[model samples]
Target: MTDRDADAALDRAADEALALFADDRRSSGDRRESHVRRPQRASDVAETVRWNVADWAAADWGGPVPQDAHAADSVSNGASNSSASDSPADGSSKGSSFNDELFNSDPFSEAASADRPAPDDRSRQPDSSPEPNRPPEPNQTTEPDQPADVPNEAPEARAHATPWRAARTAAARAAQPLPSVVRPLGEALGQTLAEPLAALTDLPSFDTSAMDGWAVAGPGPWRLPSKDATPEGTGTSTRTSTGTGTGILAGHAEAAPLSDGDAVRIATGARVPPGATAVLRSEHGKVRGEGRELYASRHITQGQDIRPRGQECRRGDALLPAGALVTPVVLGLAAAAGYDELTVTSRPRVEVLVLGDELLRAGLPHDGRIRDALGPLLGPWLRALGADVVATRHVGDDPEALHTAVSASTADVVVTTGGTAAGPVDHVHPTLRRLGAEQLVDGVQVRPGHPMLLARLAPGRYLVGLPGNPLAAVSGLLTLAEPLLRTLSARPAPPPYRARLTEAVQGHPVDTRLIPVVYQHGDRACPLRFHGPAMLRGIAAADALAVVPPGGADQGAEAEILDLPWTADGIGISADTATGTITGTGGTP
Candidate 1:
């Protein structure tokens, strides 16, 4: 069918579908009203409409609709709503872009044409003025490390401050006096080395054969003697019945020196004799004269297939510098270098306190109480970030209990979830004042976790307050705890890397937004949905957190990425197929 004919058929089908919803419609004259009315009984009209749209999209557009694309029905609804609003009182149709809009919007945004106008044409014009209360474009150029903008009518106390500066200040002030520990090699996987790894002895201490071969004294085509009639008391060594050279095993010690025309059958790694000039591989030599005699068939080159002493390293040579991470390969290398133990930086001890009266430890939400997601997640995450999580305590919103818990903890850092705000039930700030603690960071200019704070309780003790929301708490952990633990454990900061955003990220007008993103296999990053401050869906599946500036980042704009402690190394390469877990490396959510 022709394109125009197909458009007319679609319009007719949409009208029929709308007619079916007449019983649920509002009064006829409310042009701008678009929502379906509440039905007295359960109905399937919405489902029918969605299926119809999906069918039409597939058949007319020559593309299959993504089964999980929930936005398809919404696009159809928008077009229907536009048609309804454009209808005249006399029942005449007004020209509209409904068909054009529907045909152009692709379910996967990457496949959509940039030049194609949006369903709402106003969005396509850069010069179009935004609504007065609407946020500005996220790609606005801003100075480095500047605070995000505050709303014009916002109170002075609500000024959005720089988060990076706050993190730096907290880290600089977070110091611990714990002594280094000598740990067995097997126990030093995640720990940073406190001293250089030096070789105890020279590698390959003696000259050896590099391959299974014959150690020869000189030129080839040499003959071996027959064992026929030599005097029994003669001053000559015994030989094999075939008169081949005596075979030398790898660990044979006290091997006699070779004369100018002699050859010794030597294995790989076997020590060469004092007077041996070269080693000829087994494949290069031949036996002749039946079983009584043998001859070296190939010409011999001096010093071939011989491993000289101390080829890898000399005794006392430094192998690994201090502060190196003791990974599996490092462990093997240390063992080869004769180190039984490693001196590693001490892990900073941290105690966690989860505060909230309306939190349940397990099960689905009931009676307005939510499951305690942070309690189960934070401990392991902190350990992954190099903190020794000593204990985790769940204390309800009781100020006295909170105060006691904070006072009794002997850990280097106390991480408290919730109770940092100024609400009546939020007792963290007031309790800090009562205990005469100094607040290092009051608030950060980051979204979802802006209420996070850091305080110093004593010379070597610290308190970090994280927001109660599951995802917000994660932001706080990375923003405050990561740096603090890194400093306390004396681990060096990782080098910075940035990824170009594959899609535009909406930025807060004044606050830097820490967006949950998965690095695509293409090496760019794409933002995930469901990343609201209270939601954990995005962060749970993210490979890294994109540090968006106040104005946000545009498609293809480079943004700094904060790697997650557990999965950063395998971001785009690792896959957990059993559970179908995506590692934020461009996999689908």
Candidate 2:
């Protein structure tokens, strides 16, 4: 069959299907009213028309329908008016003996021609009727039965199971360009630094006294004769005199520059007088002779309890370089170093798109709907990873709506929480293709998030496709979101840790594994045995996600694991040493 023919058929089928469904709703409403009132016979005309149109639509483009190159140009006209009595459902039940004849002698069979035009033909206009509310059609083909919601399950899961590979692939595919370097410090909290930072000034720029004491000018071991000292002794006399006098004074009076034997008192932060090199505590000194005499119990060292100029840090030194994650401590240090502001990278903005028709915002399903947990689940997770969510929206399983939402977002990263499967309503993959996005990783080998897709829309712009399931969405966010953020920030991927598996883990032989687990010791993390992507309780209780090798291994086997670090500050392997576990020291075990 031609692409043109297929396109025409699809267009007609879609239009007819939409109209038929609308009429069906009207008929159904009429029947309900009839039941409420007196019993009345309702014409089945609308039902037959709805059934035929729906059946035709499902057969044309619903699930895995092979494309014909020529069907694309077959026709641009709308559906033709047919007699409502010719319902496809009636034909199936009453004409069972003629089923083969109808199937073999189908008039639309020739519609699958090879001379189809491209999908973007200006002559084609989409059917305007809104999608009908209907249950998914049951699989009627001869193909093997697969999970209705997730069809490409096993292979995609296996592809994304490797964290390192997935991380690298995601990073490579992330198109968000590195932002300009001149962003404000407030906005750069989570961004990577474009350049290194140097200290602007020396901490403690001037010599300051650490304690309130007399700044003396004399050699060590200078003797203060007890006979002439005050009752409080030499140290007390010195302290008292210095407190009273401006500098050093004579004859226990307030004056400047005391005589050799005279003592002056001083307060905390008071500058020491010239010729004074040591501080003797008042408690250790003795005073005698009506406060005229003072004596020291011990010798004092020079520069005692004094902060020298440029002690903590020197001017122009590299206090903190660019690309370093700024913590509160870092901010404090920078402030102390006399920097009013800093030049840092800018944090990437993200937009979360939740896609599905069966998903409900809240409450129980009145029809066949289910409450959506992806939005609530992913918003916090992305925020925890340091990505700023500028906006979040829920798009029902409509391809055009999904396209519009994604196209309108100016965020660096766009995450779609569902609609990645091949089901009729699964529109993410096709919508992305329509948007001119370059697919980096179409599918990964991993559990729960195998259908995840990573793509680049433009420079500094990324799109990550997540499965419709809540757990799958989370897994995709973790596996793909991490690297995408890093790439935008220009940060390197964190290294993996070689952890000893405390419990045996079973996994597919061909796929890499990601098992959510908890670390016991500070450095040595052991895998928590129980896990399920769909079960939020177990994942919530987990401390880390341990990566098991492709094949299953026994307990005590050392496997590379990615540390979730939800509660920790840094990433990388925790080094287990003989003394203590070391982390964030740039060492690996």
Candidate 3:
């Protein structure tokens, strides 16, 4: 069924539920005003229910939720000015209150069931072809949808937060590779190849001995080059006085040419002389007449134990394709292929603006101030992600300072920590508006970091606003910044990795949740505890962030794995006992 059909159905169900709530109150009421807050539409009914579910379950109209980075704007928008009467004369006549009704029966159960289709229902399939201006359903899985379905650089698409996959796709498509640069091999690590790494010359470059014994020409029973005089039926001359030594060694001058029936000792990696056929290993050859003659203890054949020139690759052969990440092994290969300087995609320069006033730079939290974890956390983390973190400065909550910091940033990507929400002190949105930045992604439909946003400062330059909370900021890093930077650096996107969950993970009702998980028992991803948006304990020890879909994941359900930058080296930070600093990563995160 279509998204609108489902929403309309849910709206109808919500309307009915609201009507039931009113009717039940009236039938038993002795003319008491019903004071429960309600939603303006059915789509909001579920969110409203979620907002109050905790309060009603506790049988109390709790105080207002704190306005913070974690609290969604949608949740705080539905404020209530009225509540039920504290005392009623006819207690029995008042009947079950709304709380009791909610506890006894689910308010949105029918709507949820109607919205979700049966497992075997053919109509459950998502519409592959959506009309123009259509937004994807929350549960719909996308696969490189058309430009119309997924807006890359358009502002009209900002009406709704792009789906997680679509957001990544758009981010990657939004920027191009910065530019190619020729850097020495020493500085090329962690960069991407801007052009095909073709072999400058033949690998090995020359035929070399692959063994430590005789470099024999024309087969076995060859006479050896020795210092002793030639005995009867034996042979050769000393290689010492005439040359440097007997055997040819690696990184030395070329050996004299060998004629048929003559042999010379050679070391592994030593260049084989012209007319040499095969090399007999030291262990496989027998020395006769006190080393005057050489004989193969085992049969020797032509071209044995020899590395031919260009054995691995020929001149001008592509060693690695363009856009390949230059790793340590790649460095070795390039060096082997005769490359001293490489043309690689330059690392995208990132300037991190940490925004907060209450955050303490050092010392224990005192007088309502906490340590600044993100400042220490983001720099090296971004560096590990292949970004050249040029600078990380603490930009206070002052709007003017933030604008100045952002406007003056010459870095390719400007990452700001905190102040993305509509809180009284949140100034990110206002600054962006003042700067006329085109917001590509205002917010994501993901938990913990939904307030994160992406805006284009100019062509090929962008800004990513991250939440202040450590974990939420990490989520923003992975969600928006990662794809953008990866694309800008011309790094190939990692293959989609998935793992089956070892246990169930409760999910957000509407938004996607990134659960920090560790791999156990092979490929099973086990969820860790203390995964709240504000807490960094779980993610500090996580192997990857699992992309748990809406409505949660069941046991053994496969979820996409977003790898951590430090996952390869097992990046982990030991949280301080007092939550002040994580004793690793050279930072407090």
Best by lDDT: 3
Question: Which digits, one per residue and each the tens of the lDDT, describe model 2 over residues 451-528?
Answer: 677888876688888877555566677678777776666654566567777655544323455666666565544544
Best by TM-score: 3
What candidate 2 gets wrong by more than 4 Å, as runs, is 1-167, 170-173, 181-187, 211-216, 219-276, 279-299, 360-371, 570-589
lDDT string for model 1 (1-589, tens) is 9645554555455446644433222222111112221111112234335443332222122223333223434453443343323434212235534433222222233422243232223122342343545432232212212222222111332443346556655665567535789999877777788989999887877898998867778775544434453322223344544456346667657466777776666778888877788888877777676633335565667899998888988899999898887777889988877889999998788888888887776678888677878867877787777767777778877888888889988999999888776665788988899899987887787776777888899988999999887777898888888888878877778898999987766454456668778878757877765565566766777788888875556678899989888765321122213311111111111
**Ordered list by TM-score, greatest first:** 3, 1, 2
What lDDT does each candidate get? 0.64, 0.52, 0.68
Q: What is the lDDT, from 0 to 100, of the residue 183 in candidate 1?
A: 96
Using all chains and alpha carbons, the TM-scores for the candidates as numbered come to 0.66, 0.60, 0.70
For residues 184-215, what per-residue lDDT tens digits would candidate 3 score against the true structure?
Answer: 99888888999999999998899998888778
Query: Which is the winner by TM-score between candidate 2 and candidate 3?
Result: 3
* Predicted structure 1: lDDT: 0.64
On a 0 to 100 scale, what is the lDDT of residue 393 in model 3?
A: 79
lDDT of 1 at 577: 32
Looking at candidate 1, the ten consecutive residues that score lowest on lDDT are 579-588
Listed per model in order, the count of residue pairs whose N, CA or C atoms clash below 3 Å is 2, 72, 0
